[model samples]
Target: MEGNNDTVVTEFILLGLSHHPRAQAMLFGVFLVVYLVTLLGNGLMVVLIFVSPLLHNPMYFFLSNLSFLDIFYTTSSVPQMLVNCFSHQPTISFEGCIAQMYVGLFLGIAECFLLAVMAYDRLAAVCSPLHYTLIMSKRLCIQLATISWAAALLLTLIAVVLQPTRFCGHNVINHFSCELQAFLKIACSDTSLNDLLIMTNSIFVLIIPFCFILVTYGRISLAVMRIQSAKGRSKAFSTCGSHIVVVTVFYGSAMSMYLHPQGKISSDRGKMISLFYGAVTPMLNPLIYSLRNKDVKGAFWRLLGKKVSE
Candidate 1:
């Protein structure tokens, strides 16, 4: 059997969500529907924001970018998972696994920073209405978005490059896709450095932004309280309510999964919580924003009208 020195791992078996055939089929159906909704919802948001002239403000601009990132973030893992559900031999090459991990990490981190930037945009608009234009100019928005993407890419690159610890044990990943924690856990060599790096990155990427959002909202709340009319306060809170809900769900799930001691929680529970932030949250974002915001709804109608006219 040892012809030369070619010990190639052709593929890796993905120990997907379930082993039972019926369970796999059921799970596949559910994820297929979820994936479709995620695609359509995020896709529509991007298109509407892009084409609508009235939506050409800093807020909607950030929203469009968020939608785009959500699409990729969900797609990076969910489709692979859906495929694995039905595949008799659910496998991904080593290179493919690495690529998936990189994309997922990059987009997930980018979304965190982008959401924080969006909070700052809202704060400037609400707290300093008079100088909103001067403060959040198109150029400045572009700069902030650029920084978000650059930071995310840098973090992902470092993580991927440092993950050279050989996989000497079972090649089968327990989860559907190549998750960072799962991959690190299975490494044959010491992963203390990798763990430290991941923790450091998580602090800056997730914890810092979460704190920034909290402070920004606190200022916004004070500003809202100062408004003379109850209607004014209601309107201001309504404008922020959707973003607040999203921020809470995303950061709450993420922090619980990463910030705490993983040894305390069962592995299955951890995977389930990870699915909420990684898979479900992206699918829910556009629905929450569009359903709740009159501006976005109006833009949707306008876009629809233009399509009909065309």
Candidate 2:
């Protein structure tokens, strides 16, 4: 990265969420807890789904994929965020910043697609109960998960390859991490192309998948209403309620941050939004599913009982 006035830009100073030492200490404790919970919660979900025969269906298959994604997704930035909270002047190497930016992008986009896939899985279970097993077979589940991950990889690669090589101005990033929008704000060179790429990527990774989820739930609602049994309708809604909450938090924050027109971004607002989606949402995902989902609770106790007996 070229620096202004012949100074080579080697790293960036992160102006983290708070400048006050007291506030930083408080935030450190808060985020440390959040990070640990994200890891343990999502990690347990993955292990439980893998080990429990009761969770071997397509729904839990997609869920396990989501669990893995949340684990990595939060890990990409939260560790650095925790470190920055204690540092008087937080800095990230140029290479490290770039790595954080793209890694988060990849995992975040994967979740967007994965959530859509989960919505489709719910539609099958509720709308086509008789054929749900046939429609969401093992092969189809693997293929869908593979495509979600592969597509995110390809999109992230394109964004990286097309990024402007010159970053000739300031090296101070005004956020906790090297967030995409915050990173873009620091580029001294013309970033019209980069801005365009972000918009296009947002459409594919955020907009389209969100729309798909909405339509899928629309179909799901109609199917549930058609069921004559109140018990059946209640069951159908229970199956989708957790997913609906997760999608709203994740996609709503992401779209607000990424889809806004250039120059409309507020520094403070962006940081808060990033914190919610990046840290808060990942931690909430496993909790939401486990609390709302009876099968997950059942499998957990069953595993606990087996270990206790052993």
Candidate 3:
């Protein structure tokens, strides 16, 4: 309970993205736009998929889940970061920080697994078109979705339960939000067990799922190459184009952040890396999926026409 000088640390001060008044103002505007776009974009995707029967299949089913995750992921942390941007002395109660850390970790891990499940769906659609529906039945889809969420919950609980309990040092977290790694730096208790747990969970939640995605995409590529008609090949590639982009952008920054050796990267650079996935990636998901796909556009037009006719 006692921190430095035998003081109890009850709150953590967040050194937000910037300290300069002008810079903080600019960051506030930028992140505010990003937060709003992330909400509207991901929110629209969920609603669009829900109403469009054309998007009722496994691909969009998974996409709708992804959209929901993106919404939750950004909402969990971005609002707090935005508030910290304007506060003269941005601080969060120790309990608030713990809650933020766990929620953010769970959503992030869930996305990692959900993306891998999506890759498998793509594999089925491309590699076995005739049996794609049979392979990705509603039951299997629900099971995969449930497992992704349940696994993330289990892993996050383990990390939190085994985390270093005592905080006997300074309570300044260098990052904007209560990031797990940033919070861990402020812990006064021994963190070897926590470190091991993070690494183990990262392997399951990041490295393994990412590798699975890569291999699944490789098989899809091979299957596409064997398609006899040019139109067929193009269509197959188009079906997966958005997912591939999302996976690359999400996993690239995430793996770089988690898998790389800790303490080797600078604090500011680490914040930038986190910002990409935490803010930028969620904003890009709906854009990437909608802009590149003909199905979503067609569904939008159809819905628009139905509304006008009514």
Number of the top lDDT candidate: 2
Report the Cα lDDT for candidate 2: 0.91
Question: Model 1 over residues 150-170: C-alpha lDDT tens digits?
Answer: 999999899977884465644
Tell me the lDDT of model 3 at 279.
81
The better candidate by lDDT, 2 or 3, is: 2
lDDT of 2 at 16: 84
Evaluate all candidate structures by whole-model CA lDDT and list the values in order: 0.85, 0.91, 0.87
| Per-residue lDDT of 176 in model 3 | 87
TM-score of each: 0.94, 0.97, 0.96
Give the per-residue lDDT digits (tens) of candidate 2, residues 243-288: 9999999999999999997679888899889998899999999999
Name the TM-score of candidate 3: 0.96
- Please say which candidate is ahead in TM-score: 1 or 3: 3
Show where candidate 2 strays beyond 4 Å.
Answer: 3-5
Which is superior by TM-score, 1 or 2? Answer: 2
